[model samples]
Target chain A: MAINPLPPGAGTAIGIDGLIALLAKLPGLGPRSARRAVLQLIKKRESLMQPLARALAEVADSIRICSTCGNVDVQDPCAICRDPKRDAGLICVVEDVSDLWALDRAGLFRGRYHVLGGTLSALDGIGPDDLNIGPLVDRVRKGDIREVILALNATVDGQTTAHYITDRLGALNVDVTALAHGLPVGGELDYLDDGTLAAAMKARRKF
Target chain B: MAINPLPPGAGTAIGIDGLIALLAKLPGLGPRSARRAVLQLIKKRESLMQPLARALAEVADSIRICSTCGNVDVQDPCAICRDPKRDAGLICVVEDVSDLWALDRAGLFRGRYHVLGGTLSALDGIGPDDLNIGPLVDRVRKGDIREVILALNATVDGQTTAHYITDRLGALNVDVTALAHGLPVGGELDYLDDGTLAAAMKARRKF
Candidate 1:
């Protein structure tokens, strides 16, 4: 059985298998599907592959977490953090960068963002230090921010994180609110469609 | 409208936006999800992005379709085609390479494969000629191939494709057997778990 072996330095050096493996590491892609994607990308290289390569290289070179909010950005302070037009008085806190994207898609939330990086999880040993809570507290202490919206997932870890952030912000006198009970139990903000997110945001109640 | 003009040349020269756009072109990923993926890949570039980029390039350079079986491969005939242990006399007809992978995972049929590339669809103008049927017929006539398994999906289009191949193979005087009806209606072989697949093959009936 003269089965063709994978070429030397194939995946490690970057090849089809490497591409499939990399794509598989994404949130939803798997090995089999990643293979198909690699095939498709190859088939559409002129239109897709070269552009993708350049994009991959550029992101690899430039992307970094904003020191203030932990949002991935090309600049030191992300656009939202630096924009004076955005509502600095209101800070919207979220679990991940994806959550921020979901809120951005809704085209609401004129306020700036505070990405917590992740929720508190005793099971996973994630604590306040693991998250970007220090910068958030500093922003609150500056006295420009009057409200902090905890747009966290309704999971146990998410709620725990929300409560923890609330406690950290306790010394500051500010209105703390959360998205209302309209969010289905354990539903991720990313899974909620634009209309549902809009509704939940509109009906937010005091935490 | 103060979007910082997307930072000049970032619109098309390649970066997060371009990567997100390419990802969004995939079957299930959308622009919002694509952005999230790009971010994730950037964070894990050493383990993910670099390898993926290499794979993308290799596939872009080396991959193509098997002229005989329609399986996507690095070579013209594909690895399965050159495998001597596989029973060339028994041909398993499938809708696509994905189906071939499903059958391989089950490790049932030690036979060879003939990928139709796609199903027969009158509305979409797909017909037998559009598939690998002619080449399959040619192979059957040349080889000592005996049983041909119809492992196509249970969808109308899948059935239609199977029947088209069957009708074409009528003159070839070979036994044409189809996968069992135990497969749920409107079932796709890829979605079925391993046990069901094994059971289906064990109970496969005549066409």
Candidate 2:
């Protein structure tokens, strides 16, 4: 792979190019943004970059995926799983750690989370056995769980995975629910697709 | 300062909050994007995160601002400053290291660089002494400099700084020149400002 997008003279110094390359691979950063980021980091070496580097090192050294819920954390069970304050009976299932983080950021969900890693994708050769479905089923079957919130994406694969999980948890006497489809806050009706608009219209309540 | 924009439970994990906070401060990365980047890093811990962490640490430990020209590099004088092949008598003055890097990336400038750190901004209380103008003048006065290219931004402050630098180098026998102003390549005339269009018209060459 073309790791360094920057030309030879632009980053002739060792590790600078490497750092930029790695940063570019991040979610919201491209080559141009990565270059800018690296420059900013270098400029504020003492104040920002050093601290960030230390934090990254520390996180890389300590972080682990929770074997039970698949949440990324320092602890094995993760903070949510370990938290006695959270509702252990309720589990909110998400497709990835990012989704779990997003829900956690909202601060409304007082329940535990189950990260599925990804949805069922026949094209990608991913199935139930590949995901955290087995563990989720195991958790649900153990009978302490009162509900399983299927907070998966609205994509075909996501819905498919959710349906499969719902089927698996059918034997258990647990309440299964998915996230309500609605027009997003600050979202314009004209911008929304037919599927989302239809779903939102169908799920509309007397508000 | 509120470093982390994410709610409490979103990053309750050990060192994870700190990492997210740090990542959020980076250019092109907000709290949401930072969280996503952090999750990605965690997911690809061994392949991406660890290597990035190591590279960041290494760069932070070794990188230094070149005392001679203020360019960032692993060495004190920097590779560009120490390079024997580059034209020692010609110096390109840029407002920031990023500008210098951009020029270097083009691979056309065989001359050395002089990073001004920033432009002269009286409102911001930045003066000639705040920039590397003194060092640049000193470099010229000490002899060998045949030309000084002012590759500063097209902003008012940038122009003012360039003029100030030119004034400072008045006593020296150095040929000073600013970058030519024109409509950028692939830039639409309608999208361009009046000043750029006028400049481009005035500087138009026979095809």
Candidate 3:
């Protein structure tokens, strides 16, 4: 039998095999999608492949963690932390940089952000030390931050982390607040779970 | 509004924005997944992002089209075409390199391949002259090939291209054959379409 009778990577170019292997490790991309992507990328070398390679290189070289909030960016403190117009007095706490991105996508949050990096997970052995809860407490104590909003997900780990942070900042004199639980914007009563319906009813506002 | 009140790609590092845009352009990777992938890439910079960047750059720099088979690799003849063990007398023609990869994945076909690049599409203005059909005919004419297998998709354009190629190679004295159409392996009979069921019944073998 020939060297590559089993398909790619086995007999393909070293560069292609390496690229496919790395691409497959990405969040949503599997081995099959990675192979297809490599083919398309090579086909569109000038238009997409070269540019993507350059971008990846530049990002890998320049990307840095924000010492202030655990956010990843090219700069030290990050853009959000450096922005003068943003309300530094109000800080929104989140579990990950993805959460920060999600909240920022709404364009409604005007305050600065504090990325916890992760939440409390007993099963995974993650605790307060593994998170950035210490830095958050320090920021609240040192700065004029009046309120700290917990915008974590509704998951058990997320809520547990939120509560843990709330308790940690209780002595810091900062008004710790959590996001209001309610039915989603397009969520129907019939489709919503009992927890969501109860929370929506409990937080119901009068017209 | 602040520089990046609307989220990423606006003021969040030019490298990151460029990476996300290019990643989102890939198949199956949308804007949301792209952002998440970037975040993960940055987080796992040393192991994933840096290595991925190097891999991308290497692939972009070294990748080349197989002059003989239209397969994209780091070599002109491609690994499959250059393999001495492969049966050069038998050629499997496919619409694209993706099809070539799919066929090779089965590891059953021990022959060379001819990538047409794309199928004949009158609607899209794609014709025999636009594809690698000329090169394929030349390869068959010059080489001592005895059989040509049309492994094109079952789509209208695919079948049309297959017919056109068959007519072109009719006088070449090569035995032209197409893949047998039948119900796919692991496909349930109940889920099989009418056309597939009919083909399966008609192509049934001796018990």
Candidate 4:
């Protein structure tokens, strides 16, 4: 997304070129890779390319921001928010939909989610008002929520945003917790940083 | 394109998941990268995602394989084939449209192109009939073509296809040429292969 992915004479004018330009904007694909992707699409139009086009169209028209939880889905409240099995009283807060997908994919959480869209960052001028924090706090204030888990990234911006959200929901009579920071699963101890080593040692429990 | 790029429980059922699966089939994007791309798309639906969907639709509806030169474009004859500025008497034959694009991007060739679709490969079960070889020969038989330059890749399959095309058009009143083999521009001599070194030595000429 940072680099110009269009060729010498290519732009958004031609449909093929436009597709290439748009594909180039996606993460991990530069202009050359986009061109290769487009060529492969063209080569396999029936099996891959046309199907992808239809899928993109369908998602574009159907995918919506969940009014309750901020997850992008075909429904207003989202599939997770609508699910009867998921615990509505427990909400896992995340910085983005990507984070939501990651947590969901892992099958680590059985509760609903509240996507903040992004962490609060002064450098990028991202504030509380810009995110979906108000809706989250309102959901908690409506009173069924028993606990809020801060599943944000362990970065400065992530911690800052988590602290701010904690303060906002301080008077709501809900328990606020955070994900434990330690060596990740399958992580090599020798390759880990000092901070992680320290955290892992401090959080070590009896076997 | 080799690896199945999706995580567990992600597939072509849900719109977002479908988009991710389709994107994963692209050359470089796998399931995880596809998820990241889809998430990024969802995050910027208006500026990027929706536009990409629209472009894909437009291309799907408008793109046509050129009947004359086998190029994929908006026109049947293709823009290059229709252009009067290029030398119609000369044709550069390539294995695929991507090869054509690469050559065209260089701005080195002033003639039109003939895309073979693919080279003849016994391992892949590809024959001369599988490619657009007959059309190439037919084009030469029509008598306007003065020279047919084989610009296929410098692989065994490429050479075999080129030789097959040359033999097919041997009885015709046209000259068949091929791309010279030597050290590529900006390619270091120290890193060159023995075959390439031998070829470069054999093909050496006055500087």
Model 4 lDDT per residue over A1-207, tens place: 133344322322577888899999999999999999998887787898778878887887778888888888866667787666788899999988889989998997999999998999999999999999999999999959999999999999999999999999998889999999998999999999998999899999898
CA displacement after TM-score superposition, residue A188 of candidate 1 (Å): 19
- A1-207 per-residue lDDT for model 3 (tens digits): 234353434436467877888999999999999988888898788999888988888889988888999888886678888877799899999988888988988999989999998899999999899999999999999999999999999999999998899899989878999999998998889999999999989999997
Can you write out model 1's per-residue Cα lDDT over A1-207, one digit (the tens) per residue?
Answer: 344575422322344455666788887677876767765676687888877776676677777677878777766577667666778799899988889978976888888888988888889998889888888899899857889999999788998888988898998989899987667779999888886788789888899
**Candidate 2 docking class:** medium
* DockQ each: 0.28, 0.51, 0.56, 0.40
lDDT of each: 0.78, 0.87, 0.87, 0.87
- Cα miss at B183, model 3 (Å)? 1.8
Candidate 2 or 1, higher DockQ:
2
Fraction of the reference Cα-Cα interface contacts (below 8 Å) that each candidate reproduces: 0.37, 0.66, 0.67, 0.59
Q: Per-residue CA lDDT of candidate 4, range B1-207, in tens?
A: 133343322332567777888899999999999999988887788899888878887777777888989998865667787666799999999999999999998999989999999999999999989999999888998859999999999999999999999899999998999999999999999999999999999999999
* lDDT, candidate 1, B1-207, per-residue tens: 245656533432345666788888875577766777887797787877876666666677777677778776666566677666788889999987778877877889887888887888999998777877888899888889888899999788998888888888899879999987667889999899887788789888799
**Model 4 pairs whose backbones collide:** B5-B31, B6-B31
Candidate 2 lDDT, A1-207, residue by residue in tens: 223354434545457888888999999999899999999888788889889888888888878788889987875667777776899899999999888888987899998999999999999999888988998989888749999999999999999998999999898899999998878999999999999999999988896
Q: Provide the clash count, candidate 4.
A: 2
lDDT of 1: 0.78
Interface RMSD of structure candidate 3 (Å): 2.7
